[model samples]
Every structure is written in structure tokens, then in C-alpha cells.
Target: MPESNNCCEAQGLDAITAKSHMDESIKPTEPSLIQQVIDNPTGDGITDTNLRVPEGCPRIDPCPAKAAIQTQECETEKGDGDNIALERARNAPPGPLGPVPTGHGENVPLEYWTPLGDLTGTRPAVENFSLSRFSPNEWNEHNKKLSAACHDGIQVATTAGFNALCSISRAYAEADRNQMDNNIRLSTRAGTIHRWTVELERMIADIIEEIDLVQEVRRRTMRVKSVLQVVENIDKDMMRIRCFRMDNDLVRDQVSEEVTKELSLCEEIRDVYIRLLDQIKMQIEELITAKRRVEFDWSEKKEAYEIETESRGLGSQSDTILWKAGSTRIPPDQSSPSGYEYSTKQVLAEGYTAKQRSSTLRVNVDAMIEKAVKDLRDQADRVDLTLTQQIQLQEQALRRLEAELYKDLQQLSDTETLIDEMHDASKKLDGAMKCAQTRLDKRLLRHGVENCRDVPQFGLIEEVKSLSESVSATLGQLKRAENSTSSLIQSRRDIEKEMVVKRPVILTVPYYVCDRRSYKSNAQLEIQSP
Candidate 1:
């Protein structure tokens, strides 16, 4: 062999020897990266160096066909080296790798991996190895891109969340507004109900008062009717007695001294009867007048009572009516003339002139005189008898009249007593009404006149107070019920909002092993691994 050739061969063998020694060193230490990553995956110094070749590797000696042989060997070795690196990477735990050199172990560049383990030990070499190198500037640039993407995603999610929250808030606000409106409606309804109730109560009270007044009026009328009936009965009895007396005196006659004396007695009796009849009639008239007066007074009082009751909204059913009858003396009628019949002897004794008598007797002498006198006497006696009988009947009628008069007087006396009693009763009633009015006034003064001012002469204020209290209590209860109902409705709405409406959201990425040929074929690659 030539010296130069030998020298070249020796140099080539030396290179080979150095590469072999380097390969041996790398082969033994290569597994250390995997072990180190596995033991402490998140350790600060741990990296992807375990998948990369070491600092030294075996090389070939030079030959006459060294170029071709070297090329073939290089191609085979490169293929084998890539396979070994891929295998190592597949088995190696994931971490940031150091820089990779271009030619051999020195060409591997540094790379980065996230905390989440993303490597299969058999990962292919990146086609853009320079692009894959883990320079601080590049890493920062990648982090910025990732941060931007994450920020965009976060912004989108936040926008969506904000819109959802706004929608929910709007719904809640609308619901609250609706609830407020409902409450307002309920309050209005309650007010209306209270007003209606108060009106109804007032109407009812008015009706009751009117009914009571009617009843009171009815009672007063009945009382007055009874008193008037008594007066009518007394009047009828007086008329009957008068008629009987007049008829009895119309059918009697006689004339002797005894008859004349009896006639005188009858006349006296007639006078007494006439006087008695007059007294009875007078008494009747007086009683009627007094009763009318009492009725009139009662009517006036009733009117006053009604006025007061109406004005005060009070009932006058308990008021009373009182009446009485009275009597007066009756004067005799003096327009009609009266006369007495006398006997012949009685007439002569009255001193008629003798010439007149002689002339009166000359027509028939003694017989004629006797006949004329006797006839006159007979006529006179008949007249006397008639008069006497009339008088006697009159006397009996008079006695009956006197009895009627006495009865009438007694009735009048009783009526007077009744009148007195009625007057007393009227006074008492007046006093009571006055007292009631006074009490009412006092009550009004104490409680204020707003309620009672409309009443003209109202009676008792206690009654009004009681009625008002009842109405107020009822109104209060109605208000309470309305409030309770409103509250219940509000609570129901709140429950619905809380329990039936309003829910959280979750995102994922997957790990993939890339094919080196596929990665190398394109400048940019999109892997669809789901």
C-alpha cells in the first residue's frame, strides 16, 4: 500500500473507532433519559434528550469505493438511526428536549413539551427541525400564540356567559316587575272591596233605621185609633138617650088638681132631664175636642220624633202615644116657646072681668055657660093631662138623662185623669228624648262630630259608636286578608323563579403520533385526531 493511502485508511479507521466508542457510550446512556423522565416527569432538569443521539457515535474508514460505500452506509445508518431515535422517543417519557444538531447527535435541536404528557416514544422527526428547535424566543412566540388562542376562546366563552347571565337577569327583572304590578293590583282591589263593604254597611244601617221608624209610626197610629174608638162609643150612647127621652114625652095626657100637681112635678122633672141632657151633650163635645187636641199634639210630637230619627239615622219604634177625653156644661135652647094649661076655677081665680064673663055666658044662658066652661075645662084638662104626661115622661127621661149625664161626667172625669196621665207620659217621653239627645250631644263632643253631624237631632251616640266599630273591624279584617293573599302570591312567584329556572359548561384535547413521511411531505399539516 502507498504511504498516503495507508494514512487515509488509518485516519478513517480512527474515525470509525471514535464513532464506535461514541455509539457505545450513547447506547448505554440513552435509556437514562427514559428512566429519569419516568421517575421524575416534572423535574426541572428533565428533557427530551433521551430520544436524541449522544455526543459521540461510530464512523466508517475511508476506501477507494469509500464515497459510494459511505453513501450507502450513511443512508442505511441514517435510516437505522432514525428508527432507533423513533423507538427511543416512543418509549421515552415526555419532557422539554435539548437542542438537536443537524448532522448527527450534534444536529438535534432543543424542543418543548407541556406539563400534560403529549409524546409517544416513537414520535417522528419533524420535517422543519429548525422550526421545531426550542429557542427561548420561539418558545415565547409559541406561548404567545397559545395564549392568544386561549384568550380568544376564553373571550368567546365569557361573552356567551355574559349574554346568558344578562338574559337571566332580564327575566328575573321582568318577573319582579310583574310581581310588583300584581301587588299593586291586589292593593287596588282591596281598596275597592273595602269601599264596597263600607257602602253596604251604610245602606244596611239606613234600611234598619227606616224599618224601625215605620214600626214606631204604626204603634203610635194604633194607640191613637184605640182612643178615638172610645170617644165614638160615648157619643153614640148620648144620642140614643136623647132620642128615647123625646119619644117618651110625646104620648101622655090628663087634668085634675092632683093631675095638675103631677103635671107640675113632671114639668120639674122635664127641666131636670133637659138640663142633664144638655150637660151630657156638652161633655161629649168637650171630650171629642180634647181627644182631637191630644191627637193633634201627638201628631206634632210624632213628626218631631220622625225628623230626629231620620236625621240621626236612629229608630223611633219605642216612642209612645197618649190621648184623653174631657167634658163641659151644656146650655139650654131658649128659642122655642113653652106653655102651661090651667083648670076653669084656676082661670077665674086669676081674675077675668065679670062683664067679659057675662058676655061670654049670654049665648046659652046657664046650660050654654056650663057647656062652654065644661068643654073649655075638658079641653084644658086634656091639654093639662097631655102636658102632665109629657112632663112626667120628660121627668123620667130627665132622670135617665141625669144618669147619662152623670155617666158622661164620670167618663169625662176618667178622660181628664187619662189626659193627665197622657200629659205626664208625654212629658216623660219628652224628657227621655231630651236626655237621649243630650247624651248624644255629649258623645259627639267627646268623639268628634264627623259621624253625627249630619243627624239633625240624633239620640244616643253609643249606638253610632258601636256600628262604626263593627264596620271598621270588618274593613280591617278584609285588608288583612288581602295582604295575606298578596304575600302568598309573591312567595309562590319567588319559589318558581328559584326552583324551576337557571344550570355550568366543560372542553377536551387528545394526544396523537404523527407519521414522519406525512409530516415531511407538507410545510403545514393538519391532523384530524379526535
Candidate 2:
């Protein structure tokens, strides 16, 4: 068998030599190839070649051809015998600390499966299982080396695992802290936005209330204006009546004069009402503008509240929480925090100012309305009182004139009767004179001495003269009585004409002014409270 092995080895060597020479002859010769191999012995550089031998270097140890041939020849020559030998080698017991392998083996605990005891300085009972050829010291040293390597590997793995756990735990803790901080910030921001929303709501309410009040004041102004206009018209009518009086009757009487003054007062009141109405309208406009601003601000606050609430709802792990494009960048027209606060403050301030002004305007309007009504009422009362007094005086004068007229009429009748009686007496006297004259004429025919100065003729002449003077006195008295009657009639007519001019004024003032007052009171009641 040894001889056959030697023969196989020689044949394998010769075959390798011949094959190598043949490959060398077939390939191209390059002088730099040797230098390339020398520079990169493992061919692990830029080149793809593996380890190479120089031209004159010895052949590689454990030649592949020699081993192959040896293995094949041995198998051909003794197949069953080689199998028995291999099985026997496998069944052999290992040494104290396990088998000392010379090649790569299974990665398992060979010492645990085989032996874990000290080496004995004794031979094995079976020659095939003997470990006499292997030095115990060397096997122990190998076992110790392998155990140390495994322990070192385990220690390294454990340390790396612990460090990885600590690093991961720290990362989780940092993420939790970050999330907590973000939540706190969101909560604070939402709270601030909510507060702003509440403030806006308050401002809006104030503006709305102001607007309502302004509207109410406007209505009141209109009502007051209507009342003033009515009063003014009545005064104008009274003045017109006075103006249309007859030229002689257009005297500046107390009633007419007072009517003119009342008209002027009415006109002044009307002008005041007009001014107040204008002011009310302007105030309404301001209130409306302020309300609009408050509403706009309230809308902004509402939107901000929603946005903040939504933002607060987002979480790190939420699917909806995503990266927004350019989210970190500010808009061009975006206001800063201070500017935003200032703008909000300005809106609130304007609304507050409008509310204050509205309140003040309302107060002024109320005061003006009260004053105007009071003034007009007072003036009307004064005029009514003066007219009543004047009417009473005129009435008294008419009564006196009537009484005087009656006396004058009676005196006139008595004077007329006396004049008639005096006329009759004159007639009788004329008859007596005629008869006496006839007697005297007859006597004169008898004797001129009988017509001479007799006592009877003298008495007849004196009686005729007395009767003539009484008739003339009666005529004078009758003329004076008729003149007095004419004067009394003229005074009564004047008093009646003056009463005609004044009676309508007294009627108009109290009734119309009272109606106006009632209307104003109703209007005030109808107005809504702010």
C-alpha cells in the first residue's frame, strides 16, 4: 500500500508539472506581471487576480493534484476499509477538555458533549480511541484559548446590547419631553385666543347696544320735531290772523303782540329740533360704523379660535399632522405680535369710544327734548293765560259800554219827549199870542190909548220868551245823548272785533299743545330700551 501511494504521488507530481508548463506555453508572457503580483500578493487591489506564484518559486504546499490523486487511489484500492477506519475515528472518545481539532469544525460545545475533566497520564483501553499522540498540555491550552474567546465575545455582545437599550430609552424620553412642551405651548396659545374671543364678543355687544340706542334717539328726535312743527304752524296761523286784520283794526293790541312773540318762540324751538335731529342722524351713522368694525373683529377672533383649537388637537402621531409646505415662513402681510395686539386694541377702543359717545348723545337728546317740550309748553301756557286775561278785560269793558249805551238810549228818548212837549207848549203859546194880539188890534181901532203899555200885554210877551228858551235847551240835551249812544256802540263793536282775533288763539294753544304732549309721551313709551 505504501508503494502504491508513493507511485500515485509521483504520477500526480509529474502530471502537475506537465500541465503547468503547457498552460505557461499557451498564455502570453508579460514582464510586469511578476511585479504586479509582488505589489498585490493577494490580488485585492485594483486587480482581479488571486495569489500567484513567481516563475521559479516552489510549487504550492498541499498541492491539489497530489491530494486528489491520493484520495482517489486510496478509495479505489480500499473502499470498505477506509469507511471502517473513518467510522472508528469518529467513535473515538475525546481527551479531558474535548477534541483538539486541526481544521474548521462545527461551532458547538464539544467539551460539554465529550469530556470536561482533567487529562489522565494513562493509556486508553482501545487502541483506536487512544489520544496518546496529542499532548494533554497542548489540548488544555487550546481549550483555554477557545473558552476565553467565547467569554470575550459574550461580554462584548452584552455590553453592546445594554448600551443600545440605554440610548433608545434616552431618545424616547427626549421625544416625550418635546411633545409635552409642544402641548403646553398649544394650550397657552389656545387660552390666549379664547380670551381674545371673549373680549371681542363683549365689544360687539357694546356696539350693538349703542346702535340700538342711537336708533331710539333718532326716533325720539323725529317725534319731537313733529311736535315742534305743529306748534310752529299754529303760531304762524295766529300771526297770519293778526296780520290780516283791517288797517284800522290792525292795532298792536296785547293779544296780537303776544301772538307774534309766541310765534318767534315756536320758530326757535323748531330750529333747535332740526339741529337735534341732524345730530341724532350723525350719531347713528357713527354707531353703525363702529358696529361693523366690532363684527369684523369678532369674525377674526372666531376664526382664530377655530384655528387654535384645531392646532391644539394635533399630535405627533396623528395621521392628519403632516408637513406643510413653507409652513415655517411668515406671510408678507402678516402682522407681528405687537402689531396684532395693537390692531385689536384699536378696534376695541373705537367701539368703546362710539359707545361712550352714543350714551352722551342720548343723554343730550333727552335733555334737549325735555327742555324743548317744557319751553314750548310754558310759552303756550303763558300766552293762553295772557289771552284769557285780555279777553276778560275786553269782556268787562263791553259790559260797561252796554250799560252806558242803555242809559244814553233812555236819556235820548227822554230828551226827545221833552223836546216834543216843549214844541207843544210853544204851539199853545203861539195861540195865546195870536188871541192877545187880535184883542190888542181891536182895542187899537177903538183907541190908541188902550194899546199903550198895559200890564197884561207885558205878561204875555214874557211867557212867550221863556217858552222859546226851554225848547232850545231841550234840543241841545237831545243832541248830547245821541252823541253818547254813538260812542258806546263804537266801543262795543271794537271789543267784539278784538275778541274775534284772540278767541282762536286761546282755543288752539291748549288743545293742540296738549295733543302734542300726549303724542310725545306715547312716542317716548314706544321707544325701546337699550
**Candidate number of the best TM-score:** 2
Residue-by-residue lDDT tens digits, candidate 1, 447-519: 5555555554342555445445554654555455455545545554543333222100000000110121123
C-alpha TM-scores of all predictions: 0.20, 0.58
Clashes of 2: 0
Using lDDT as the measure, the top candidate is 2
Off by over 4 Å in 2: 1-172, 253-272, 314-326, 330-337, 374-382, 389-393, 427-454, 457-530
Query: What's the residue-level lDDT of 293 in candidate 1?
Result: 39
Superposed Cα RMSD, model 1: 64.6
lDDT of 2: 0.59
Backbone clash numbers for all candidates listed: 25, 0
